[model samples]
Target: MGAPVEIRGLSYAYGSGDLARPVLREVGLAVGPGEIVLLTGPSGSGKTTLLTLIGALRAMQAGSCRVLGQELAGAKEAQRVLLRRRIGFIFQQHNLLGFLTARQNVAMALELDPGTDEAGRLARAGRMLEAVGLGDRTESKPAQLSGGQRQRVAVARALAGDPGLILADEPTAALDRQSGGEVVRLLRELAKQRGVPILLVTHDPRILDIADRIVAMEDGRILPTEKAEPAPAA
Candidate 1:
């Protein structure tokens, strides 16, 4: 198979005609299996927009984007849904249902795959929570956990489904130095072990060391390579 994500000349905009605001311009990118790629840029640079398109969360507006071996342009909603199922997503907000326990939130993701029985789903959820250092908090509601712990639950939820690709947007934005480091460490370890490629968007310099490659963006276009240059703060 090819790279988990491959793009060529991708572009997207909001509005139309003279009122249109372009967010991405002729973007091209790829994320390899088991690779950790960081998308770094200032605010309004279209990093999140690119991530949404690759995750099938948004319809393709223009250009070619193939994610997890599926072409996104012109893909039907059903096809996009299936593609989304194969990808994991993490965001700035933990987005855990306040009433649900960590394991329950993770199991919710398993529901997308009908192949697993309810019991199996729960069991896998427990294991994944443990993997993310949340074994004791499996039954704890999101409200009961600390910010870092809740984010860890979010990570478990994203990985429990055994997705082929992981797209994270500012996952560490709300975290402290120690918490952010722990979160990215877990993600890197899991990605390497499972051979799942990760496309992470972050302006956090503390976690840049986790990336195999850092692609910087500015003004809706990818910046030319400059070795070890840091991304601007959001």
Candidate 2:
């Protein structure tokens, strides 16, 4: 099965009455399996908002959003929760539980599924952390890890569920250039290897070269997809 995401005429608004303001307008986009789509825009350009919508963190206020063929526009609360478990999400902030170890944080995702056994969940979490280069730090708390490592742990947690779609919001914003590049490369590799579609929201141009396609946004509207120039051969 392919990882297909479709958003049509999507719109989102904040506040109410006279204070209400729209954040997105008529936004439309589609991402296929194994596609690495980079969404770039300045702060308040609705990039994060768009990601939140795609991740089912917020309700669809207008238009339609379908992930893996399920419509999100009018989905009930329970349905949204179901969709969330199927979609992985990485935010700018690591969002790890402070008191929990990295391995525990990753295992939390699997706990939602009744079919997951305790041993299998831990094994899967450990393997995912190792894949993201955090194998040795599985027992460490978020406070003990570096910024890049924390982000990697977050990535590992996202992948623990074996989601078909991954949505990342400025995941590398807190890391150094080299670390950020490495993280992007890891995400691309995961997408390619697992046939998962990745929608990354970031303002950094440094990692743009690693994306399969770039979608620029302005004032909440998605610009056309542009082919990014290839990186220099190593």
TM-score per candidate, in order? 0.95, 0.93
On residues 59-92, what C-alpha lDDT tens digit does candidate 2 reach at each position? 8889999987789999888988888889999888
Number of the predicted model whose lDDT against the real structure is largest: 1
Q: What's the C-alpha lDDT at position 123 in model 2? A: 87
Task: Give candidate 2 regions above 4 Å deviation.
Answer: 1-3, 231-234
Best by TM-score: 1
Q: Each candidate's lDDT (Cα)? A: 0.91, 0.88
Clashing pairs in 2: none
RMSD of 1: 3.4
Prediction RMSDs, each to the true structure: 3.4, 1.9
